[model samples]
Target: MTDRTLTVITHVDDPSIGVLEAAAADNSWSMTMVAPFRGDPLPGVADLDALVVLGGPQSAYEVQDHPYLSDEIAYLREAHAHEVPVLALCLGSQLLADALGGRSRPGDNGLECGFIDVTATDPESLLNGTFFSFHSDSADPPPDAEVLARSDRYLQAWRTGRSTAVQFHPELDGPGIEALLALEGAKLRQFGVDVDAIRESIPTSGPQPGRRLLDTWLDDVPVRDPAHH
Candidate 1:
């Protein structure tokens, strides 16, 4: 309990855990960041008190182009088997699905970007509310997963054992969303997404429902003895 560690696997630079940094600080949890995109080695799951996999622009199915994704999928599978608490966002969620006997594919409903309202499909689910979303892919979670939430277009969140996966980002705030737009805004416009309008519509109230969801996950992460695992 004295050195709680949260390992973050980031696929890209832009979408680091936004609001979660503050949560880690407030909870006195130390964090280690791993960037597979930059060829940083992934620390073993046993070293972690919890795990977080951030979003990225890469499609989960493009393993041929990004072979490191295979490594990550294996890593995630190991973590899941160990009952490690995982909070997977966007691309990370897709990867988790792929690792857990599920599937990730191009969304039939097209791109689900901007702030979208997600409804809790399970009545007892703790996840519901507006979360930032910017992705063209979707995960059909593993058969055993408890489907928790969804947007009108696709599955938004699900839980299986100790892992919780969300297709929408719960870690992004206004500035984070703005930075993401700055990186891919033009590409979004090609798909009829009004980047400028999304920018204008950015909430000034700061991160909310997302932060609440994150807090719920944090509270549920189990602390483990290093020697025991």
Candidate 2:
């Protein structure tokens, strides 16, 4: 069996981490967690088999507020240039879109802060149905990017060349969803969100279907031959 390592960049202690860990373990791939704000960059990211950029509360356009956002985007660009497999989630996805010459803009309608259904724009296979969304920003796919999915609130997902970015949080499960609801309760309230309504919108069983989609996505990612590196 070929050994592969996937690097994950994260800022907050999200519940999705657990789901990702479980998914990687099941696939026999090891994962290394790194915080760009704390950890130093790897010597050669190309050596890594796959890359996963996780979400944060920061916006991709707020480079001045969070300088590391630029660094992370640069790193993603380098990885993409090297043709390394990449999957970007939430803010990470916006960063990917921005790094590839696209723009992430604040939504005119407002924040999308619940379980929303996304329709597949293309038969790309990695994304097909509804996904959990929790962002206030929207991204326009780069010129070379192919749109894979979308929803009423924003551009739900897109794929550019070898990389894919999703605005939704597929890694979130029951507990994670609950935690988010608790943490962002004030924000939700300010937006006139009803807690019971939000809770009711989320299925009691968590996002198993989304997990299945992720499993299929991992299998579809083009594995690189170690010999090439």
Candidate 3:
């Protein structure tokens, strides 16, 4: 654990994992970044302490258009199969679902875009229930995955083996949300989103300390065993 190194895969620039980086720093973990959208090479999962896949606007099912994502899903399967830790966010979560023999597709429940309450069933919510969201896709957990959190509309979080996935954006903050809306507001409006209402829903002040519960998840990532791969 002395040379703890983690990898983060970011699809786009805006919604980068802001708070989660701090959690990584808290443990002095070094992060290697890969951006498939930019054509960065995906690293071998067995080589790192953990794998973190960040949110993006693309669907996990969009591999045909973004074929590099097929490589990503393949890496996730290798990671899961070898029992490496994974913390997949939003689109990454969907990719994890697909890697685990499930899928993420557009749902009839409409878009869940904005700050929303998420019910935690495992350890339960000790802090405020709200987490930021901006996607229409939902996922089915693998047969062995534990449903950790949810909203009335979608599966917010789950885990299988050492891998954890979440549809919400716990890594996003005020400026990040503003940037996301700037880029996607028009398309979201076409989906029946009220831009002003969503803006108003954002907390005026900084979020509570426990805002990034990923700290707990990262803390629990099991040590990588050379033989496991």
Candidate 1 residue-wise lDDT at 132: 81
Query: lDDT values of the candidates?
Result: 0.85, 0.78, 0.81
TM-scores, all models, native as reference = 0.94, 0.91, 0.90
Give the Å error, residue 180, model 3: 0.6
Candidate 2 shows a clash count of: 0
How many angstroms is residue 5 displaced in model 1 relative to the true structure, after the best TM-score fit?
A: 1.2
Model 3 vs. true fold: TM: 0.90
Error of 1 at 47 (Å): 1.4
Those runs of model 3 whose alpha carbons end farther than 4 Å from true positions after fitting are: 1-3, 123-128, 204-210, 227-229
Backbone clashes for every candidate come to 0, 0, 0
Local lDDT at 152 for model 1: 93
Candidate 1 residues lying further than 4 Å off, grouped into runs, are none
lDDT of model 3 at position 115: 80
Question: Where does candidate 3 clash, by residue pair?
Answer: none
Q: Model 2 off-target regions past 4 Å? A: 13-15, 123-126
If candidate 1 were superposed on the true structure by all CA atoms, what would the RMSD be? Answer: 1.5
Residue 46 of model 3, lDDT score: 65
